[model samples]
Structures are given as structure tokens and as C-alpha cells.
Target: MRYKRSTQERSLTSPARTTAPHVKKNVDRYGTTKLGKAAEKGDLEAVKQAYEQSPDELNQPDYAGIAPLQKASLKGHAGVVAYLIKQGCRPDVQDDQGDTPLIDAVTNGELDVVRILLKHGVNPHHSNSNGQRAMDFLE
Candidate 1:
């Protein structure tokens, strides 16, 4: 036999028992369009200002799926790249497709950029889902 009616089903209906859906912080939406584009244009001051104004600048990505560091490296902007590194932007942070800044440097045949990325802790062995690593992207 069942345990009979205990405290009734009302306990399960308590208003406080309801759960709310999780919502991400709105800050995540703020990508450094200014900073990333500045990196592309080799605008060091703009890149610096963008980073200073938005600490989350590291998370910003361009339309090409390139993060700030990736954009800087792609443009071969050593100054902007160095400044981003100082602000804690990682070179190996892959985009949606897992294309890291190192991959961009390698593919572009930017030797200095690749060396800088490697020095900043980008793993050369890391691969995307397509099985392409920074090494694969190398010229």
C-alpha cells in the first residue's frame, strides 16, 4: 500500500520551489568591434583605448570570427599585438571554428607573429574539429 497522503501535493506547488531559467550576463554581448577593427587598421591607440575601456575586450571577435589578438596578428601589428598580450588576451583562443590567432599568423606566413604567439603560450599542436592545427596552417 502507498504511504497514504503525507503532507499533500501542495508542498510541491510552493511558489518558492519554482526554478528560473538561467540568463547570461549582458556584458558577454560587448565585443570589441572598435578594438578588433583598429587592430586590422594598425591603429594602436584605438586598440589601446578599446582595451582600457572594456576589460572584456579579450572576448571580442570580428565578423571574420577573428578575436582581437587574431586580428592584430593577421595585420602584423606588433605594437597592438603586444599591448593585447599585456592585457591578458590569449593568442590561442579559437573562434567558433577553432581557428586560433596562431593559425592566422601561420597561414599568413607572418613569422614574427607566429613566434610571438608561440611565446605567448599558443599550443602548436592544438587542432580544430577539422583536424587542422597551427602546424597545419603553417606555410
Candidate 2:
């Protein structure tokens, strides 16, 4: 369901880098440009480089509103997951479908990922599109 925008779309939506004197409003200055996929695949080096170039990329939501940290959790990428949390990514960020990282981790039976996210205070009670909580997925 993740679609890569065409060059024309990227150009059209790319925000103008404004100075302090001319702040733009209601624009996602930081765009999701394959970093979320890299994070989900647990490529720490790619994640590192992406963050180095645009640390704000960590906060950028995909069209589905899924954050990179959430993808990392769903894929059970522990190293990237840890690094993302240390970098201040919220473990409880919900996607447009209301699915948090904890929800994915639990449903995938990834106990370690669930533990790490819980340590970061991700709500186990957070429901997803199906109205199911993380605890509901626990065995």
C-alpha cells in the first residue's frame, strides 16, 4: 500500500525551506523518502545515515501515517528499534489505521519488540483498526 511518489509529485509537494523570518504553515517539511522501508527492514546503517541527513525524518508519517519506528517494531528489528527509541521516537505512535508499534509487535508474536516498546511506555491498551489492543494479541 506504500506508493512512491513520482518525481513530479515530489517536486510539487516539496516544501520551500523557509528562514526564521518566513515560516511556512501546514506543510510536512520532512518527507518520508524510503527511510521507513529501510527502518522496517532493520537496516541500521541506512537508518543512521537517513537520520544523520534528516533527523526530523523520524517524525515524518507515511501516507498511512505509519512512522519509521513503528515499521521497525512490526518487522522486529531490535537494533534499529532501540536506536529509534534513543533518538526520541515515540513507541506509541498510531498510524492512520490506529495501529501502534506495540500492536504490530504483539500480533507478530515478537516478545522482545513488545518488551522494548512497553519499556518506552507504549500503551498496551491501544486499539487498532480492528479495535484490538496489544494485550488481546498476547498469548
- Candidate achieving the largest TM-score: 2
Task: Tell me the whole-model lDDT of each prediction, alpha carbons only.
Answer: 0.67, 0.74
Can you write out model 1's per-residue Cα lDDT over 1-139, one digit (the tens) per residue?
A: 6676433222122333221221111123333366676777889888778667656656555333567788778778877788888788876777768878787788888788887877888889988879898787644
lDDT of 1 at 19: 18
Error of 1 at 96 (Å): 1.5
Candidate 2: what lDDT? 0.74
- Over 1-139, each residue of candidate 2 has an lDDT whose tens digit, in order, gives 8998543333234343222211112224443445676797899999888888667667666555678988888888988988999998877788878989888888898888888988888778777888889888878
**Runs in model 1 with CA error above 4 Å?**
1-32
Q: The CA-based lDDT of model 1 is what?
A: 0.67
At residue 80, give the lDDT of candidate 1: 79
Residue 79 CA error for candidate 1 (Å)? 1.8
lDDT, residue 54, candidate 1: 57
